[model samples]
Structures are given as C-alpha cells and as structure tokens.
Target: MRTSPFGRTALSFGFFLLPLFCRGSHSARNQTANVTLDASFVVVEEYAFGIQGVWVQHREPTNCTQSPEKPRTRDITPAQCNRTCFPGSFQPPRLSDCNKIIESLLNNNTGSLQANPHTWVYVYYESCVAVFENPDEDSPTLQYNWAVLGANVKSLVNSCLSTPDQNSIGGACVFDEYDGKQLSNVEVAVQRFTDFDDDHDDDE
Candidate 1:
C-alpha cells in the first residue's frame, strides 16, 4: 500500500496524529483509525485495540541450509530474510523502528518467533492499548502505536489472545506481559463478526 506522495506528505505533516481506543466497553469503532487535524498538526484517534498489532506473516520457513557440524542457525537478519511484504506496501510510522523491535523480539531464547514472512513483533509502550475491558492507565486512551509491515496477522492476533502461545513465548520477557507475548488462541476472538458492543469485551 504505497502511499501517494501527497498522502505521505500529508501524513508526515501529521504523523503524530494518534487515535483513541474506546473507554468502558468494547467498541469496534474503537478499532477504527480516524484522522483529522488540530490547527497546528494532524489528529488521529489511536486505539490500543486496532493499533495493538499482530504480525507480518504466519507461515513457517520451508527450508534452511545446514551449517557444517553445527545446528542450523535461526538468524533472521533482514538482509538474509527469505520472505517479504508486497512491493510498495508501506507500514505505518517507520519500518526501521519495526525492524529493530521485531529483530529484538526474534533473538534466540527470547522474543517471538519469525518464520520468514511470518515475522512477529510486540506492542510498544502500550500505555495506549487494552485487553478485555481494561485500558492502559499510563498512556491514556492514545499515545504510541506499533505497526507490522506485511500480510494478514489474524492468527498471530489470535495467538496473542490465546493462553499458552504468548505465555510460552514470552512468559518471562518483562513486566509488560500481555503486549510482549503473542495474542493467538484467545478464547474471545470474534469468529462470528458482528457489530461491536459492551458485551463483546466479555465474550471470552
């Protein structure tokens, strides 16, 4: 999704235009990415929910060249990455920050897993996100947002919502447990998609 020069220039002028996540209940409208502008800068409604993030891909690597007398390496240096986002796709914010954060999360023993295009990254600051009915207190309703620069991250999102996947991945990562871990397997994912409502928060 390459942004037109006009779009980039416009979004850049208002890059900090963050959106708001709904308070009190589960408003999928809270899942919207709204943008306008104040007299001086662009304005965007930020949501810990929509902007919370998932992954660039979910497919596993199909091949790995073996190392002589050693276990094959899991190094995921972007230069050596086998898969990539569609040409011209522009992840929001900065792709550099996403790479750094995702790379940090992919280090052996820590971080989430990345099987080629199926790269996984974690939510930052998250003072802006939420889980269930609770919103982060530090970041208010909006602040920072994390973006993945690739394909469908629905399964990854579900992993984050699920129990053991994220826990198994980053149970000891840090104090920010939920954001750091994967959101798959969550019991409350809306398979029967419908209008957002207060009751939705407790569907799980």
Candidate 2:
C-alpha cells in the first residue's frame, strides 16, 4: 500500500497522527469538505477512494488483530523485555474502538481497518470531525515508514525509572551517555508523586 504524504506530515512532529484508507477500499466519494491542510496532514485523508468528492469503498470496521498473519514486521528494543509491561504506543487507549471498527464495518459507514496485531490504526470520529471538520482525523501512527517508527520505538520510548533513585523511572532509550541527565530530570517530575514508582514502585 502506498503510504500517504499527509500521514508523513502529521507524525513528523511526533504528534497529530492521522489514518489513510487503503486502495481496495475506494469506490466513489460521497460528500466531503474542501479543507486545505498542510501536505503532511493531507495524507491523513488520502484513501483508495480518493479525497472528498472522490470514491470511498464502503464497509464496516474489522478487527485490527483478528488475523493470524504474523503482525507487521517490527523492530524490538533491547530494553523491550527488561520490564514486565512496556507502555503501549497509542494513546486514548481503547480496545473497544477496535470493536467500533467492527461496528463501522457492519453499518457500512466507513471502510474497515484491515490489520493484525502490532499494526496500529486510527480514524477520526464524527464528533471529532464536527470539531475540526477535517477528513483526516483517523491517524495510523503505526503506518509510518517502518524505519522512522522503528527508531522512535527503540529510543524515544526509553523512559524508565532510574536505578538508585527511588522515585525516577524515566531512562534514556538506550545505554547511552544521555541516560544520566534524563534520569536527573525525572527526579524533578517524581516530586509530583512522592510515592510514584518510575519503573515499578514497590512501596508506600
């Protein structure tokens, strides 16, 4: 599948993620708005169906993890297995939204996100659109070029509680010189939660 440039723009900042529709998912555009957005954000609306006024293959949502296909090839970090649970990549976390994926499919309101585990998908909701009114609310942060994402997942996600310090868990993404300073910064954030456990807090 050709990844959208709009998607590139949205995630380039490590924020503002959007989703793209696949090619087989397009048919004809129904009704849409003409909202000029940055090239990066535009990919958020790019779909097989084309942009607004273009065709959109209609179907309900599908389970992103329903398939057994070995999930998208992912690069794991050395620190990956160090902790019992790593924070999930996506935010506003909702497994039920995947259920909504099924609902949208059944209603034929929009095309489903065909994916297996490890592949993160997102779509804008009607309510969200009512606010921004932009068609690119559905963000597929996982669809980002594997190379960039792989790198971020490895280093960017390295926030862990520090050793020796009872309060800090934020650590450098890897075993690098930078880890010490970031660990120091966390000493400040820990002030908020006196009992906060950066990695795994054991106590009162």
Tens-digit lDDT track of model 1 for 69-88: 53222222121111111112
lDDT for each of the candidates?
A: 0.21, 0.22
Question: How much is the lDDT of residue 2 in candidate 1?
Answer: 17
**Candidate 2: misplaced stretches above 4 Å?**
1-36, 42-103, 108-112, 115-120, 129-204
Candidate 2 lDDT, tens digit per residue, 59-91?
212222233343332112121212111222322
- Tell me the lDDT of candidate 1: 0.21
TM-score, one value per model: 0.18, 0.20
Residue 19 Cα positional deviation in candidate 1, in Å, after optimal superposition: 21
TM-score of model number 1: 0.18
- Top-TM-score candidate index: 2
